[model samples]
Each structure stands twice: as C-alpha cells, then as structure tokens.
Target chain A: MNSRLQAWLLALPATFFVVVCLGLPVLSTLATTFGEPAGPFVTYIQFFTSGFRRAVLLRTIEVAVITTAISLVVGFATAWVVARSPGRIKSILIIAAVFPLLTSVVVRSFAWMVILGKNGIINKALLALGILNEPLSMLYTEGSVIVAMVYLFVPLMILTLVGVLEGIPQDLTDAAASLGAPPSAAFRQVVLPMAVPGLIVGAVLVFTGSFTSYATPQLLGGDRQTMMGTFLYQRAMVTFDWVGASTIAAVMVVVTIATVLLMSRLARKLNPVVG
Target chain B: MKTRIHPALIAFSVFTFVFLIGPLIIIIGTAVSDTTFLTFPPQGFSMRWFANIFEVSAFPRTMVTSFTLAVLATTLSLMVGVPAAYALARFRIELPKFLANVFVLPILVPEIVLGFSLLKSVATGVGASIWTSLLIGHALLVLPYCVRVVGASLNSFDFSVEEAAVSLGCPRWKAFFVVVLPNIRAGVIAAFILAFITSINDVSVSIFLTGPGISTLPIQLLAHMEQFFDPTIAAVSVLLMGVTVAVMTVVEWTLGLTFLTK
Candidate 1:
C-alpha cells in the first residue's frame, strides 16, 4: 500500500468506531429535535419559553462563569507558587494539586454533602462555636453546587496554567518592577498579558466542566438547584421527554463548542506564537 | 538574584490546597466515625463501616462490574487508539487533522450529551443491551486520552530504529511490534492507567447509560447516597480513594505525574 493509504488504513479503525458509536449517535439525537411535529425548533422554543428551564440555562452559565472565574484566581496563585518553587517542592505541590483529580467526582461531591449537611461538619462547628443558633441550609443550593464544582475543577485550571506560567521568565516581571513600575502594575502589564493564553485554556476547561457537570449539581444542588446537566438527566431518564432532552443536549454541545472556539480565538489574538 | 514569592500569595495557595484536599481528608475521617450518621472528628472509632461496605452488596458487586468494565473499555480504547496515534504521528498526511478531530470529538462534546445520545441511538434505536451501550460509551470516552497520551509519546520517540529495522530484513509491521512497541511501552502503560481511572470514575456518561441491574460503582454510590446519609458511603468512598491513590502512586513511580500536564 502507498503511504497515504497505509496511514488512512491505520487511522480507519478508531475513526470508524468513534463515528459509528459516538458521532452518529450524537448527531442523530440532535436531529431528533427537528423531527418534532410542531416545528423544527419547537423543543428549543418550549425550553426557552419555560421559566424554569430558562432559569436552569441561566444558572448553568452563571455557575460555569463563577467557577471559571474562581478557579482562575485560585489556580493562578497556586500555579504561580508551584511553578516558582524549587524542584522537590514543585513536584510535591503538583502531586498535591492533582491528588483530588484522581478520585471520582461522586466521592468528591459526597464529601461536600458531608460537609454541608445539616448535621455535617460545618453546622456542627458553627453550632459548637455559637456562631449560629440554627443550622444554615447549605446543601442542595446553588452555592453548594458552585463550591463543589470549584473544588472539582480548580486542579484542571492549575494543570493547564502551571506549564505556561513556568515557561515565562521570572525576570520579565522584575525588569518591569526595576523600571519603576509598581508591583501590581508590573503584574498587570507584564505577567497577566503573557498568561492570557493559559488563562483562556484554563477558563475554557473549568467553564465547560462545570457547565455540563452532572454529579456535583445532582448530588449537592438536588432538584432545587437544577443545572443543565441534571436537567438533561431528568428530561431523558425520569420523564422520557426525548425531544426536550435532545434539545438540551444539542444546545449544550453548541454552547461548549462555541465557548472553546471563542476562547481559542481570543487566545490566538493575545498570543499569536502559542496559538 | 533570587526573588521572593509574596507571603500573601503563599498563604492563599496554602488555603487553596486545604480547600482542594480537605474534603477527601474529611471523608477519610468520617469513614472511621463510630456514629450512625456521617460526622467529622469522630466521637469514637469503629471498623464496622468498612465491614458494612461488604454487607451493602451493591458496593462489592458494582465494584467488580466497574473494574471489569474499566478494564474492557481501556483495552478497547488502546486497541483502537494506538494505531491511530501511530498513523497521526508518523504519516505526514493531511487527513490526520480530520481524523484526529474525530478521535477527540468525544471529549469536546459534553459526556452527558454523548451518554444520552448513546442511550437513544445504541440502546433504543439499535436495540443493544445497556451493558453493551455502556461499554461502547466508555471506550469512546477514554479513546481520546489513549490517542493523545500515546501520540505525545510517539512524537518524542525516534522512529529511525523502526526505519532501520524495516531497511534490514524485518517487515514494516513486524518492525513496529519489535522496535516501536517496546520503546513506547511507558506511554502505552500511562495511557492504560489514565483510561482505566477515567472509565472507572466516570459518572456523567455512566449515569445515563446504566439501566436495571447494570450499575457502575459511582452510580451505585450515587444511588446509595440519595437514600442514606451514613458512614458506609464514606467508608466506600475512602476505599475508592485508596484505589485512586494506589494507581496514582504507580503513575508517579513509573512515568511521573507530569505526564498528566500533557
């Protein structure tokens, strides 16, 4: 066989499997929304027209944005520390940062449930400290979901940022400082601009992660705090609203893809070389 | 001249680490609590919850199912992903771009979407069993990781040894097995571990794909938690974390966790 044919042949099996199993299924399911008798966009219309679903969609975006924003700040600080640390400490810190990722999301969310429950640690501690006469209802709320998601995804943000931060020379900031720029001004002018690409990458990951996350919202937020992921699950599995589910799924994919493309474009504009 | 990291930044990072790792520590602590309800800073110590993991039955059964499913899916992903990675790395072909995207399309799409899609198309449309649909979904889930990790490994490898083997008397295919495979063993192993862990821990896809009598460990735990708020779940979670720690230790020893950065 010619080299082209050989390469194509080599790539064929995985490509074929993915197309048949994943690609076709997702596409066909998206197409199912169009098959609705009322109209091609009826499911989407119904979804948007409903106050609850609109809230869910807005809440999903809100959670994702908040999670991404928080993760970026925390991850940047943590990554900066890890990246600048000496070799042994850097390795240890990276391991520490990544250790949570190795465990299941279910386990991690369960931990939050333990911490936030009425009789859980925080309530007990607050009670013991006389901080509150009554336990605050923390679990099964939007705040709880966001907190759990930040814990779940911040490591990803750190992983994405650390290498890029490490590649930046430390002297660049110092040079700006030595040139009579304030330290904060130096960071804003020198370090922050350069870190934009990594920031975008990390932001995109955390955003989409929390955007489509199922387990955390379902476990911690419950029905009271319905996000897109949990909404899709309820529509599909519980009510068997296939059209509604398909619409949600299609919208989610489109939103996720759009976020990625928009962020990549932003990253490219900011850092042409890396892009 | 050495620059100093700000004390405030150091303090903030310390807080972040505690936030990141604190929950797992709390879970571990709760696991050993003697109380019926999940609690931290135990009132007393007991091994009953660990024993209760066995008595729960779903925990042990689904653990086996999850392990078997993860192994099978990782194997399937490797079989499909290795050659694709090789072709992409070595071929210098234009189609590699399109093919690479297709291979990675699963990761780009929300896994919940993929899971629901598979449930609709494979299970309902094609009439495949839920178990088979799950296997297919999970394999697709991990396939991208397999390709990316192994492809990174392949890119760094010197292909000249395989070329030399081909030039000498060995067939091209045989040369790949004898020369290339041995060299990229670490990557393959790394990919396997990563894929296995991902498949096992997966909840988004598995949640949708699972049906009656065919639940993964995570799904089982999720269901168990919905019904009960007890230390048994904590015990089971601690055990699951143990598995993760063991796998990560192996990765640290062999490839170093830095590979995860890739």
Candidate 2:
C-alpha cells in the first residue's frame, strides 16, 4: 500500500472507535438537552435558575477551587522539598507522591471516610483528650469533601511542579539571595515566577479533577453537600432524568474546557518561552 | 555552596507527606484490627478481615469482572492505539493535530460526563449490553495513554533502521514488526500497565456503566462501604494497595517509574 493509504489504514480503527464510542455519545448527550419538548434551553435554564441546582453548581466550583488552591500551596512546598532534597530522599518523596496515585481514588476516599467518620481517628482522639464530650460529625460535610479532594489531588500537583522545580537551578535562587533578596522575596521573585507554567498546569489538573470528581463528593459529601457529579448521577441513574443529566454533563464539559483554555492562555501569557 | 532548605519548608513537606500517605496507613492498620469495626492504630492484631474479603460475594465476582475488563480493555486499546501511534510517528498524515486531539479528547472530557453519555447513548439508546458499554468506554479511556506513551517512544526512536531494513528488500510492514516493535517494547509494556491500572481502578466511568449482575471492583467496594462500616472494606483496600505496589514495582523494575512522568 502507498504510505498515505497505509497511514489512514493504521489510524482507522482507533479513530473509528473514538468517534463511535466517545465523540458520538458525548455529542448525543449535548444534543439531548436541546431535544426537550419545552425548549432547547429548558434543561439548562432549570439548571441555572433553580436554587438547588445553582447551589450544587456553585458548591462544585467552590470545592474544586478550594481543593486546587490547597493542592497548589501544599504541592509547591512538597515539590520544592522533593526537588531540592538529595537524590535518595528525593526519589523516596517522589514515590510517596506517586504511590497514592497508583491506587484507586475510591480507596483513597474510603480512607477519608475511615478518618473523618464520627468515631474516626480524629474524633476518637479528640474525645480521649477531653476536647469534646461527643463525637463531631465530619463525614458528609463539604469540608470533608474538600479535605479528601486536596489529599487525592495534591500528589498530581506535586508531580507536575516537581519537574519544573527540578529544572530550575539552585544558583538562580542563591544569586537572588546574594543580591539582597530575602528567602521569601527570592522565592516570590525568582522561583514562583519561573514555576508559573507548572503551577498553571497543576492548577488546571487539580481544578478539573476535583471539579469533575464523582466518587469523593458522592462518598463523602452525600446528599447534604451535593456536587455536580453526584447530582448528575442522581438525575441520570436514580431518576432517569436524561435531559437534566445531559444538561449537567454539558455544563461540566463547558466548564472544564473553559478552565483548560483559560489556564493555557494564562500560561502562555505569563511564560512566553515555555508557551 | 549548597544552600540548605529552610526548616519550615521541611516541616511543611513532612506534614504534607503524612497527609498524603496517612490515610493508606490508617486503612492498612485498620485491616489488621481484631475488632469488628473499622479503627485506626487498630485494636488487637488479627488477619480475620483479610480472610473475610473472600466471604463477600461481590468482591470476588466483581474482582474477576474488573480484571477481565481491564485486561481486555487494555489489549483493545493497545491494538487500536499502537498503529495510530505508528502512523502519527512515521507517516505524514493529513490533520495530524486533529487526529491526535481526537485520541486524547476522551481523557480531556470529564470522566463522569463520559460515563453518563455512554450510559445514555450506548446503553439506553443503542440498547447495548453493560459489558459492551464498559468495554467500549474503558478502551476509549485508555487509548490516549497508548498513543501518548508509544508516540513518545516512537518520537525518540531512530527510523533509519526501519528504512535500512526496507531498503534491503524487507516489506515495510515486516520492517515495522521486526525492527520497530522490539525496540519500542518497553514503551508498549509501560503503556499496557498504565492502561491496565487505569481501567481496573476507575470508578467514575464504571459507576454509570455497571448494572445488575455486573460491577467493577471499585463500584463493589463503594457499595459495600455504603452498606457496611466494618474492617472488610479496609481489608479489601489494603489488598488493592498491595496490588498497586506490586504493579508499581514491576514498572520500576522494567521501565523505571520515570516513564510515568512522561
């Protein structure tokens, strides 16, 4: 076969599979909201206009933003430590970050349930120390969801930031310090600016991961703190509200795509060389 | 002179490490607890919960399903993805960027959305079986990894050897099989392992795709946790972690963990 035909033939199966399995389904889901009898935008209007849904949307964004923010802060520190540490300790730290990633998210979230439940370690410890007479309910709360999400996603942030941080030489920071910039000033002026590309990538990953996450919010948040993921589940699987589910799915796709595009643009604008 | 990392930074890193790995340790600790309930620093030591994993009917059955699904999906993804990777790497294809984007688009979309979409369009609309939906979904999900990993390897590969083999009267296809495939073996294996782990561990996509008499291990575990607050879940989690560690060890040994970073 000619090279062009060979190339097309080689790419055919995967392209066909994706188009049929992924692209078509997603496009159909997006189209479902429009097919509603009332109007094309009816489901979307309900999604945005309804107080409950609006709350869920806002809460999803809130949890995702908080999770991303916390991941970035903690991840930067952890990544810095890992990047700057001697070779042996650095690999160990990298393993520490990568190991959790290998396990299931459901397993990780379940661990949080064990930790944050009413009779969980913290509650039991607090009660033993006479901090509280009664165990505080932590699971199913928004805070618990955020906490677990940060734990789940911080590793990703650390991995992303570690590569970029490792690329940055120690001399630059040392030179900054020698030139009268204090440690914090040196980090802010030198390290942080240079790390913006990694930070943006990490932020986007953590943000999108937490934003679209189903299990963590579902398992920990429960009905009391419904995020878009669980809400979409309930609508589709529980109630069979296809339009409603599709609307939520469509919104999620839009939000995720927007975030990715926005962040990439920001990364390009901030670090022209990397971009 | 090598500058010292600040004390506060070290302290923060320690805390973060603890925070990240603390829960897994707690689960493992709880698994060995002699107590019936889940507890950390666990009560007396016993292996009962580990044994109890077999007693849960769902765990074994769903584990088989998950394993089968993961293997099949990863294989399918590799079969589909490797050639595409080859084409993208070697051939001057029209719309290469668009095709690459299409391959990766599955991952770029939120997994939950993907799950729900498949459930709607495939399961409901097309009336496909749950197994078909899951297989298709998972294969699609892991295809990107195959393309990216294999593509990376193929990029760094020297194509001159393949050209030399073809110039020596070997068919182009045979040249690929003998010349290119063996050299990229490490990348292919790494991609397979990554895709396998991803398929087996996935809950978001599997959640919607699963039905009565069909569920993935993670979904089974989720349902089990919802109904029970015992150490069995912890036991299962620890076992899962063990499998993960073993898999990671294999990756580390064969390809090194650096492949994961790529």
Candidate 3:
C-alpha cells in the first residue's frame, strides 16, 4: 500500500469509533433540541426565562467559582510546600497529595457523608466541645456541597501547580530575598507571577470539573440543592424531557468553552511569554 | 543559596493532606465498625461487614458486570487507539491537527453532557443495545488516554529503528509487528492498565448508559445508597479503594505516575 493509504488505514478504526461513538451522538443531541414542542431557539428562550432553571444555572456557576477559588489557593500553598520539602519527605508528600485522585468519586462522596452528617465526626466534635446545645446540621447543605467539591478537586489543583512550581529556579527566589525582600515577598513577586500559566490551566480544569460534577452535589446537597449536573440528570432521566436535557448539555459545553477561552485570553494578557 | 522552611507552610500542608485523606480514613474505620448506621470511630471492631458483601446478590453481580465492561472497553480502546497513535506519530497526515483534536474532544467536553447525549442517541437507536452503548461510551472516554500514552511513547522512540528493519528486506507490517511493537511494549501496557482503571472507576457516563437489569458497580452502589445508608457500601468502597491503590502503585512503579500527573 502507498504511504498515504497506509496512514488512512491505520487511522480508520479510531476515526470510525470517534464518529460513531462521540461525533454522531453529540451532533444528534444538539440537533434534537431544534425539534419538538419548544423548538430550537424557543427552548433556549424558555430555559433562560424560567426561574428554577435560571437559579440552577446561576447556582452551578457560583459553586464552581467558589470551589475553583478555594482549590487554587489551597493547592498553590500545598504545591509550594511540597516543592520545598526534602527528598524522602517530598516524595512521600507528593504521594499523599495525589492519593485522593486515584480513588473513585463515589467512594469519596460516601466518605464525606459520614464526616458531615448530623451524627458525623464534625458535629460530634462540636457537640463534645459544648459549643452547641444540639448537633449542628452540617450534611445535605450547600456548604457541605462546596466542601465536598473542594475536597475532591483540590488535589488536582495541587498536582497542576506542583508541576509549575517545580519548573521555577531557586535562584530567582533567592535573588529576591537577597534584595531585602522577605519570604512572603519573594513568593508573591517571583514565584506567583511565574506560575500564572499553571494557575490558569488549573483554574479551568477545577472549574470545569466542579461544574460538571454530579455525584458530589447529589449526595451532599440533598433535595434542597440542584446544580446543573444533577439538574441535567433529572431532566433526562426523571422527567424524560430529551429536548430540555440536550439544551442544558449544549449550554454546559458552551460555557466550558467560553471559560477556557476567557481564561486563556486573560492569561495571555497577563503573561505573553508563556504561550 | 540557602533556603529556610516556613513553619506556617508546613502546618498548612499538613492540614491540607489530612483534609484530602481524612475521608478515606473514615471509610476504612467505618468498614470495621461493630455498630451500623455508617458511624465513624466505631463503637467496636468486626470483619462482619466485609464478609457481608457476599450476602448481597446485586453487589457481586455488579462487580462481575463492571469488571467485564472495563476489560472489554480497555481492549477495544487499545485496538482503536494504537494504530491511530501510530499514524499520528509517524506521518504528517492531512488535517493532522484536526485529527488530534478530534481524539481529544472527549476530554474537553463535559462527561455529563456526553452521557446525556449518548443516552438520547441510544434511546433513538443509534446503538443497537445497552451493552453496546455503555461499551462505546466507556471506550470513547478512555480513548484519549490510550492515544496520549501510546503517542508519547512513540514520540520518544527512534523511527530509524523501524526504517532499518524495512531497509533490511522486512515487510512493512512485519517491521511494525516484530521490530517496533516490542520496543513500545511498556507504553502499550501502561495505556492498557490506565484505560482499564478509568473504565472501572467511571460513574458519570455509565450512570446514563446503564439499562434495566444491568448496572455497573458504581451505579449499583449509588442506587443502593438511595435506599439504604449503611456500612455495606463503606466496606465495598474500601475494597474498591484497595484495588485502585494496587493498580496505581503498579503504574507508578512501572511508568513513574507521570501519565496520570501530566
């Protein structure tokens, strides 16, 4: 066979699979929204105008933003400290940091239920302290949802930031310190600025992860809260409204693409050198 | 240059590590608890729950189904992904960037969207069976990883080795099978293991794709949680966590965990 034909033959199976499995389904779902009672643009109109969906959309974005912000700050500090630790300690610390990401999200969510439930660890500790007359209601709340999400995704942020932190030279920080800057100033002026690309990448990942996550909020948020993910599940599975589900799914894709574009553009403006 | 360790940084790191690991620790503790109701810091200790998993018929059935799905998905993904990676690595083919991005679109797209979309298509008869739907969904999700890991390995390999084999009168296909394949064995193996683990632990896409009378382990566990809150799920979760740690340890020992971290 000729070289071009050989490459095509080699590529055929994956191409076929992607088209059949991914491309067609995604396109068809997006196409389905254009049909049915509400029709294409009308469904988008109704969805945005409706109070319940609008709140779910806003709440999803709000949770994602908070989760990403907390994950980034905590991740940056953890990554910095892990990067600075000595040999064996550093290796162990890195292993410990990433240990959570290896396990299933289902497992992680289940564990969080035990810790945050009414008679769970945190409430038990508080009751023991005599800080409250009764067990504080911690589980099935919006705060628990955020806590679960932040806990689930912070390790990812740390892993991303660690890679960036490792890339920076020690001499730059030392140079800043020698110029009468304290450790904090050196970190803020030299290290933080250099890690912008990592921050941008990590931020997009954590935000997208939190936004699309179904299990964390489902188990922790209880009946009172409904994020976009659970909302999508309910629309498609519970209500059997394929059109509404497809529209929501499409909106998620658009929002994710928008966030990535916005973040990358912002990163480019902040530091033209990296890209 | 001398560097000083900040006490505050150490404290913060310690606290973060605890937060990350504290939940899993609680699950393990709950597994061995003597009392029920998902209590932590157990009233006493027992292995009864671990043995109790066998009494639950759905648990074992779901375990078998999940393992079978993961294995099949891994095999199919590798079959599709390996040659695709080879083509991408070897030739400056047409729409090269586009092809690369197409393989990667699965990662960029929200998985919940993917699941919902696939659910609609399957219901409308895009796929012939629920088994096929779940398999296709899983294989697509793990497809990017297979291409990525194998492609990275291919990039680091010397193309001239295969060229030398072809020049020495070896047929093109034989050159790939006998000469090139052996060299990239580590990458192929790593890709397979990674794909298998991903398929096994996956819940998001499988949640929508699962059908009547067939459920993956995660889905079964989720369904179980909806009705009953007990140590049985914790015991199962602890076992699953053990399996994950074992698989990841193998990956780390063999490939340095960079495939995951990167």
lDDT of 1 by residue, B1-262 (tens): 5867999999999899899888999998999999998888876999899999999889899999999999999999999899999999998654646777888888899999999999899998999998899899999999998998899889989988888998898999899999999988888998899899999999999988888888999999999987988999999998888888888887886578976765
Tell me the TM-score of model 3: 0.96
Fnat of all models, as shown: 0.84, 0.81, 0.67
State how far residue A50 of model 1 sits from its true place (Å).
1.2
**Per-residue C-alpha lDDT of model 3 across residues A122-226, encoded as one tens digit per residue:** 888888899877987888788899999999999899889887887888988888988999878887778888999899999999999999999888899866889
Model 1: how far is A169 from its true place, Å? 1.4
lDDT of 3 by residue, B104-149 (tens): 8888889999988888776456555788888888999999989999
Local distance difference test, per candidate? 0.90, 0.91, 0.87
Ranking by DockQ: 1, 2, 3
Per-residue accuracy of model 1 over A6-85 as CA lDDT, tens digit each: 88888999989998998899999989999988888888889889999999999999999999999999999999998888
lDDT score of model 1? 0.90
Clash counts for the predictions, in order: 0, 0, 0
Q: Model 3 segments beyond 4 Å from truth?
A: A37-39, A272-275, B93-95
Going through the candidates in order, their DockQ values are: 0.83, 0.78, 0.70
Q: lDDT tens digits, residues A11-113, model 2?
A: 9999999998898999999998899889788888888889999999999999999999999999998899888999888878888888999999988999999
Better of 2 and 3 by TM-score: 2
Q: Tell me which residue pairs clash in candidate 1.
A: none
Better of 1 and 3 by DockQ: 1
Whole-model lDDT for model 3 versus the true structure? 0.87
